[model samples]
Target: MTETLTTALIEMREDDVLAAVRAATEAGTSPAGIIAGLQAGMKTIGDKYEAGEYFLSELIMSAEIFKRALAELGLDQSAAGTGTRGTVILGTVHTDIHDIGKNIVASVLSANGFKVVDLGVDVPAQRFLDAARENDARVIGLSCLLTTAFPAMRETIATFAAAGLRDQVSIIIGGGPVNADLALQLGADGAGISAQEAVILAAKAVEGGVA
Candidate 1:
């Protein structure tokens, strides 16, 4: 049981999480090991969300605490393309300011060696295009927490199509309100049901392996 940091993250105990992180570091826990514990906690948080034991607020609180803990441990979230696996352009879609799920995915992806270009919340469709061009990202990840952002997702995919990069770029949609149906409907490469799942999707998308 990785409950030392896992439980603190699950319980959203900011102080306890930091304390446990420090304790683990002093006890010779590798950085990857520490991050894995936090990631495990996030997986449990995601499971609770799916099981209806946790709501959006709990997700939000847990994400904030998780992010803070990462920063406390000197894990830079903004250090994009710093991984060997691949690069993933990630962000919350337009009109979806709630980034509880996005934050979790970002942390997990980074820990798993995915270079993440996180564009943050309330991102416009064109921003994705610009970021993709600037970063030359092959895997584009769109996260939607609001149902209203569905249209925005459509527009984003259309933007890629309009630019003739749809075939070259693999788009992945995720977040609380997203599911496989929505992912297919939006013509996304796939739906990321979890953070680890997103990593797999990104790794595949990079090589143009997404269907």
Candidate 2:
């Protein structure tokens, strides 16, 4: 059943994936097991995207399937924070309206037991700080697909530093234009090329370690 779910997701069969998730749930499959299967599928999808076997449209479709499966399993925002390992505030930095990558990261993190406070796209630096402070998040993830948003990422990090909260939380940046060096330059603790890596980085961040 799990394999079916994974296959359905990897194939971007939205209806099939939804059916598989529903069937698994009715069969009393654990939510964690279902989520793990979905993550496996997403990992394959990510790899295909990187290898150029899948394009942006396909990637977006896969993400949508993943989200639908999660919703079918009753594990969307309402289920966030339940048995969570920690809280993470995530958003696209100012002037960036792109959110596909950020949404994927949020779903993966939430599935992995991290409560995600998604501040949405085109978010300002101050809003990130406010959400982090309100949730006492252990990590902040900034997403930006445009090179022009690098400065915004820097400003977001600067705001954290200016507020004297830099040390209290870890900052990680992602999206097409972000890299480890860029993250460092912007005062972030780390950067991830994919949502899977972001989950690992966020885990390390919560443990007071950098990835």
RMSD values for the candidates in order, in angstroms, are 4.8, 3.6
lDDT, candidate 1, residue 148?
Answer: 92
lDDT of each: 0.79, 0.83
lDDT of 1 by residue, 1-211 (tens): 2477999888888899989988888888877777778778867876787678886566667767766767777876444223666778889888889887887787666654577889999899999999999988888999987789999999999999999999888899998778899888989889997765786778777655663
TM-score of each: 0.65, 0.73
Clashing pairs in 1: none
Q: What lDDT is reached at residue 100 by model 2? A: 86
Candidate with maximal lDDT: 2
Over 4 Å off, model 2: 30-33, 39-59, 77-85, 95-104, 107-113, 145-148, 194-196
RMSD, model 2, all Cα superposed?
A: 3.6
lDDT of 1: 0.79
